[model samples]
Target chain A: MSLRLQARKLACERDDRWLFRGLDLDIRAGEIVRVEGPNGSGKTTLLKILSGQLADYHGELFWNEAPMRRSRKAFLANLLYLGHSPGVKAALTPLENLAWYQALAGEPDDAAARLEALASVGLVGFEEVPAGQLSAGQQRRVALARLTLIPRPLWVLDEPFTAIDRDGVVALEARLSAHARQGGCVLVTTHHALAASSALRRIRLGQGGDDAGA
Target chain B: MPGPDASPVSEQQAGVACREPREGTAVAVRATLKRDLVLMLRRRSEVLNPLVFFALVITLFPIGISPDPALLASIAPGLLWVAALLAALLSLDSLFRSDFEDGSLEQLLLSPQPLPALVLAKVAVHWLLTGLPLALMAPVLGIMLSLPAGSYAVLALSLALGSASLSLIGAIGAALIVGLSRGGVLLSLLVLPLYIPVLIFGAGAVQAAILGAGVAAHLAILGALLAVALMFAPWAIAASLRISING
Candidate 1:
């Protein structure tokens, strides 16, 4: 498997506290790498830097061996990022939400594909219900449904297991492994024990615990 | 531009089989426009509040100032312009607030499409919902203010053209303060000064048209301001959003 993303000398500090200095990272295809760290440990920050969202850091990120800035368009095109908030519009129905996301990703708006994705995420009967009316776990599912809607190489998910029910968690864990087995890389941050994941490779952020004592 | 099945565009040279499929900018722009329109439409109260404010402020002038037709006509141009400008400003706070709060703005930032183009599409929808309605509703309120006979059309035309620039300019301030909880007051402080030239020319257009002095100069200047704003504000708004999101 080829290396999809590599970070060299990544030094990031937030609020005058060094989250990490000279950190290096590498992820190859068919690997589900988990980022473990406490609150404010800069797990999200590191993901943002790699995904090309946050630039308040010192690092060189290469996608397929090309500098991220020089190839930002292609990098973003292949990246699928799921943040803490579900990224679902409260007013729009699940169908509308997924359709808009697909369109923004520059995919053809296929009603069948969106419906099928929603069903796979277990939002079958509630397709037309406004997302604001859905429960928190359901709302997160609406965001997770994006995974099935489009095919992307790199998935940077922050706390994907939060508020998810047992069934949803089991299904999601399986999906992550399935995706990695298909030659996609999954970089996730979660406290949920991925006990069933044989494909998991974890990198814990040590600065989070050290900075607390300082 | 690549079609629906956008072949993975790799900056790297030959033999790289990348599989990132992207839709064209036009499609992305259309989706953003449609999604925003639907969102605003569903929140009908937010959409209508500005127009109601416009009418209420215009309604207050006769009772608060003077009911005399002659007196009202003399001051109507400036009053109408100022009221419309405030109403447009009232809607600006919510423009990026919801997107920022719900994390949709982050997704927008991460899109393969250029940020400025996507931002422009959103501002277009804002203009359509807020600016266009205010312009159309002004003529009715103009009658209340005893605006001159022929200048009613000019009032609508001036506002329709000028408010486009207002939405564009106001959006930059909206984006800058989107991360703040109490941005409504600061938004006005940041945007009001920039709105001066637009207010001057917009109000001036109707006043000139009312006098039958040929409003071409005033209207032309408003158009020029709109042109300048159109060219620059989207990029500014995009940059501000990135800063706000990162911080």
Candidate 2:
């Protein structure tokens, strides 16, 4: 199974300001690509564009050698994106959140699977507790549990480590590396460094090094 | 790197790939509908607020205008219709606010399923909780307003049909303004204008019934409006939601 994501001459403007221009990237399976930049440097914006969320841009994106627009459904089906927010409902428990999320992703509903996912994320006793009562880190964990439930080829994560503690960060890094080893690709933007022993690539936005040649 | 044995990749893939049934648009709609209902149920106040507002507004009309049955009866149809329209509008601001704030809206946008189907589901739940209840409650309020004897049934039926269009059209405005911090007033401004046609026909149906005129034409127009909304409003709402979230 071979998969590739390529972007050419991408440019984006926000609020009459040029966030980035002439950016290009290529990602392949079994590789981890990290987007590095300072605040207001368009790291999150670029991630959103790659994930097909933000469209106000000038660029061409190809997934597996096909235009992203022409094959959006297939591309999206093969992609999993986790944005800066945890995206868990406060009124729902972790298990319920996972169930709805899986259903949205077109995954089969499995109560036992959801329970096990929550447990794997160290949310054992809190499975039934509403997410509103969970701490910031615990809520983030609830969202992260999705990584275990589905095995999409590409993951675009924005600030996945925002509220995570040291242990959570280490565990998440291991998961990223493992995913890469399993022939999946990951695109992540975070201030914290990932301790993954894999073929890591970096694209530093806003600097001259906007293009990370594969 | 973690050893292959320690990695959950194989187990996770097996779990994900070995499912019996794959979800589709129908599943997406059901999931969104169920989740929204559960959220609204927990915050029962949201479901009840518009109904109470509809009742309160109806109650004030008789006292403010005049308590005489003739005076109240003459104006009851328009009064009830207008009050219900405003009440439904009041609840529109909340349709997307919580979801947007909690970041679940982003998830919905990113879902592989068609956004229009999911949006239709959300609006369906809104109608069920707010619009349908208001329609059911109109008869009780109709008696209080001293509406003509034969018009009570027409009032309830008109509202049931008219509110469906209201929910659909109002959802577009709600989606457009969801990103703004103070969108309550702007939402009304955007939606109320579009509500004119619905109001004219909805009130007309009851008026015709009271006057002993044929109510068929008004009811037909209202149903036609709802059909048009059901066909087009979902797409508009989905597009507006995208703009609000991406902009």
Clashing pairs in 1: A106-B23
A1-214: candidate 1 lDDT, tens digit per residue:
2448988878788888888777778777778888878887888887788788888998688888989888788788788899988899999999999988998888788999899779878888999999999999999999998887877778999999999998889788877776776667899999888865666888777763332111
What digit string (tens of lDDT, one per residue) describes model 1 on residues B1-247?
A: 1121222324211212245546588988999999999999999999999999999999999999889999999999999999999999999999999998898999999988899999999999999999999999999999999998999988999999999999999999999999999989999999999999999999999999889988999999999999999999999999999998988
Native interface contact recovery, all models: 0.48, 0.37
Off by over 4 Å in 1: A1-3, A196-198, A208-214, B1-17, B20-23
TM-score of every model versus the real structure: 0.94, 0.95
lDDT tens readout by residue for model 2, A65-110: 8898986787777788888888999998898888889889898778
Predicted candidate 2, C-alpha RMSD: 2.4
- In order, how many clashes per candidate? 1, 0
Report the number of backbone clashes for model 1.
Answer: 1
Task: Kindly list the per-residue Cα lDDT of model 2 for residues B1-247, writing each as its tens digit.
Answer: 1334566656655432212224487877888889889889988999999999999999888778789998888888888999999999999999999989888999899888999999999999999998999999998998998888898889999999999999999999999999999999999999999999999999999999999999999999999999999999999999999999888
Top of the candidates by DockQ: 2
Model 2 regions lying over 4 Å from their true place: A207-214, B1-4, B12-23
